[model samples]
Every structure is written in C-alpha cells, then in structure tokens.
Target: SQQGEEDPQALSIQEGENATMNCSYKTSINNLQWYRQNSGRGLVHLILIRSNEREKHSGRLRVTLDTSKKSSSLLITASRAADTASYFCATSGPGYSTLTFGKGTMLLVSP
Candidate 1:
C-alpha cells in the first residue's frame, strides 16, 4: 500500500512569492496527483502525471517526480493571496480506486 506524506504541514508565503512543498510515498504507484482545496470547498485537481513522467508544469505550478527516491515536489511560482489553500498529494494504483492523500500542506499567501 502506498501512502503519501507531506513535509511542512503549513507554509506561509508573501503574496507574489513562490512556495514549494514536498511529498514522499511508500510504494510504487501508477500515477501521482496534486490537488487544492479552498477552505470548505471540494478539492480541485491541479495536475496529474504518470509514473513515467519526470516533471510537469501548468500555469504558475510546477511538479517533479523522483520515483527512485519515492518523492515529489510541487512549486507554485508568483503565488497570490488567492493561492492560500490546502494542497494535497494523492497516489493511485495497485487495486486502488480512491487516491491516498497526504495530511496536506496548508499554504498561506499573505497580502
């Protein structure tokens, strides 16, 4: 069973700055995904890259995967107050339908 774990449960960044977070997993996976939740809102999928992928980028976000190390990192460049939210890493594969999510990384972009 693969389980995701994130470092620095909370992060504070100045508006217009960049924020980065890391995640580690226990087992092999088919794919890894990153999601964002705003307060009480449901999570919105940020990105998903397969195991064969090394890196992916979307808008102000960049994600990297190091399967050999079983670790991943998410970077949000030029963040804004609107980026204040909880970020989660999820894993899927090996007879798993629902993704196993990390506790989460709460990002606070101060105005």
Candidate 2:
C-alpha cells in the first residue's frame, strides 16, 4: 500500500508534556505532510516537508523526514489539552497528484 501506518495507534499524555508519533510509508514520495483532525472541523494541515528537507519546525511542532528510510516523525512539544485529536500523515508520490493518508494516531492530552 502507498499509505503509511502510524505507530502507537493511541497515546495519552498530560498537558505541558510532549507527544511524538511516527509514520512509515512503503513507496517513494515527493512530499510528506502532518495534519490534525478535530472532532467537527476539517483536517488542519500542520506541516509539510519535501523529500529534500531533513527537518522542519513550526511553533511547537517539529517534523523530520528520512528519505532513505521512507519514514517521518512528528513531535509536538508543550502540548495543551486542546491538542487532543487524531493526527494523520499524508504523502504524495513522485508523479501522483493525490495523497495517501495513514490510519492516524489518536493523542489525548489531559489537563
């Protein structure tokens, strides 16, 4: 499958702590992205790193890509209770316009 599967299907952590999620994809990709889905809203794009980029950070979020390993990781630091949601990783293949998404990782942050 072109889609990746996130590790630790679910995670629970306290506010002010950090949460990390890993994703593994099967095929080559042009870019990989991290997204957050809340209960009622549409998916929110978190970060997208190209195959050439090794690491990227936005606010409290950090993402790393290893093209050689076909793997990527997302790290959320100083997380808050509002951060509780399902996170997904999406990848676009070299010549494909559509993106394949992973099952997702559920993160629960308690106050």
RMSD of each: 1.5, 1.1
lDDT of each: 0.93, 0.94
Candidate 1 residue 60 Cα shift, in angstroms, is 0.5
The residue-by-residue lDDT of candidate 1 on 1-111, one tens digit each, is 438998889999899899999999988988999999999999999999889999999999999999999999999999999999999999987665678999999999999
- lDDT for each residue of candidate 2 in 1-111, tens digit (9 for 90 to 100): 548889879999999999999999988899999999998889999999999999999999999999899999999999999999999999998875689999999999999
Candidate 1 global Cα RMSD: 1.5
Clash pairs detected, candidate 1: none
- lDDT for model 1 comes to 0.93
